[model samples]
Target: MLWLDLEGAVNVRDVGGIPTDDGEKIARGRLLRSDNLQNLSPTDINFLVENVRLSTVVDLRSPAEVTSEGPAPLTRIDRVLHVNHSLLPEHGFAATAEALLVRRKREEERYPGDPSCAHYLGYVEHRPDSIVAALRAVNRSAGAALVHCAAGKDRTGVVVAFALTVAGARREDIIRDYAATGERLDRILDRLRRSPTYAGSIDSVPEDHHRPRAETMEAFLEQVDKRHGGVLSVLGGNGFTDDEFDALHRKLRR
Candidate 1:
C-alpha cells in the first residue's frame, strides 16, 4: 500500500516493495512515510501499530513545531518509541533578518529555478546530524519505522531518499517515491491549512507552489551526488559506519 487511505493522514504511504539497484526489492513492513499524525483516529493508530507493526516514529519536526503541535496520538502507545531529530536550522522559521537574507542567497545559489529543491538541500546542509539520527532510529526500530514531517514531502523525502540509497534502491524509484506525494498534494495542503501551526505557511503560498515535481527531487539527488558524493557518502561522512549500513541493507532487502 504505497498510498494509504487514512481518515486523519492525507499522505501516508509504505516505503517498501520498491526495486533496488541490483534488482532486489525492499521488504514490506520495514518503513513508512507520512504527513502529521496529530489527529490520527483510533482506527488509524490500530492499523499502523497492529497491521503495520510500527514500533518507532522518527519525527522530523523542529522543537518549535513539536511544542506548537503538542503530543501526537502515538504518545500514549506503550510500545511505540518516539524520536525527534529536527532537520531544520537552529533559528528555523524564527531566523533573524540577517539570517533570512543569508538563507535566501544560499537558496538561490543552490537551485535558482526551484526554491523547493533548495529547501530539500537545506535539510542536509543545515542539520546533517538530524538526518543521521533519524536513519539510526529507523535502523534501530524493533518493528517498522515511520518517518514524517508536517507534509511528509521535503524533510521526510530527503531522509527516506538517503535510506533508500543505503538500501541500494534504484535512483528513479527514489525520485518516483518523492513525486508520488504529488498525487495527494491537494489533500496534504488542505490538511496543513487546517493546522494552526502550519496553515500560515500553507496559505501564504499558492497551491501549485507546494506541488511536488519529479524534477525537484531529481535535481536534489543530482546536487547530492555532485556535492556530497551521493547519499551513501553523506551517511558515511556523518559517522554512520559501513557496518551500520550493512545492517540496514540486510533489514531492508527482500
Candidate 2:
C-alpha cells in the first residue's frame, strides 16, 4: 500500500502495487482507500480529481453521518459518482460508527478472544446485501474507485481485504495492507479527535486500543475461510459472481 500524502485525510492510500499470488502486481491510481473525506481541501480535491482521476467515492458511513457531517466537497462534483453506501446497521441514529468500534472492543475485552473479528465478519454475514451493493459500485466505476469509512480501518479494511483476496493478492500482503493503517495511527486519531461526530467516543478509549493489528485481520480472514470457504465464497453467496469480481479486478488492475 502506497500512502497518499493528503492534507485532509490521514489514512488515504493507493492499494496498488501489491503483488498477487500469480506474480503480477495490482495497478496504481485505480483502487484507493481512505478515511473521512469530509475535510478535503481545494488542493486535495484538485489532486484527487485531476491527478488521481478519482471517479467514484464509495462512502461506507451511514445516512446520519452524511447529514451530520454536511456536504463534502466530493459530493458536489458532478463528474464523480458518489456512492454513499453505508454498510452500517439500519437500527437508528444512536449507533454511530465510532460507538460501534468501542463497543466491539469492550465485547472483545469481556472475553479472551477477539469479538472485533466477528464485527468484521458481520459485514459479510449480516450485511451481504450492502456488501454486494458496494462491490457493484466498485465494479461499475469508469475510473478509480476510492473506498472509505470513518478511520478507514475496520469497514474499509474488510472491504479492501476481500477485494484484494478476490483479485488474487497474497494472504500476507492483505494482512500487511490492513496493518499498514497503524503507521498513520497518530495522525488518524488526531483527525478523528477534531471531529464532533467522533471526538467524544474516541476520547473515552485508550489510543493503544485503536491500533489495527495484523492478527486481528488474519483472524477475520481465517474465519471467512473456515466458515464461509474463503473470500470468493463470501462474495458468491452474496450474489457477486466470478464475472462481477473480474470486472472489479479489471477496474483495480492495470
Note the Cα lDDT for every prediction shown: 0.88, 0.83
- TM-score of each candidate? 0.94, 0.92
lDDT of 2 by residue, 1-254 (tens): 78899988999999999999989988888789999998899999999999999899898887887787888888889989998767766753344556666667654653347665767876776677777788888888777889998899988998899888877889999999999999999999998888887777676657887899999999889888998898888888878987898887776677
Tens digit of per-residue lDDT, candidate 1, span 69-101: 899999899999999999988875542445545
Error of 2 at 210 (Å): 0.9
Error at 234, model 2, angstroms: 1.1
C-alpha lDDT of candidate 1 relative to the true structure: 0.88
Off by over 4 Å in 2: 93-112
Question: By lDDT, who's the top model here?
Answer: 1
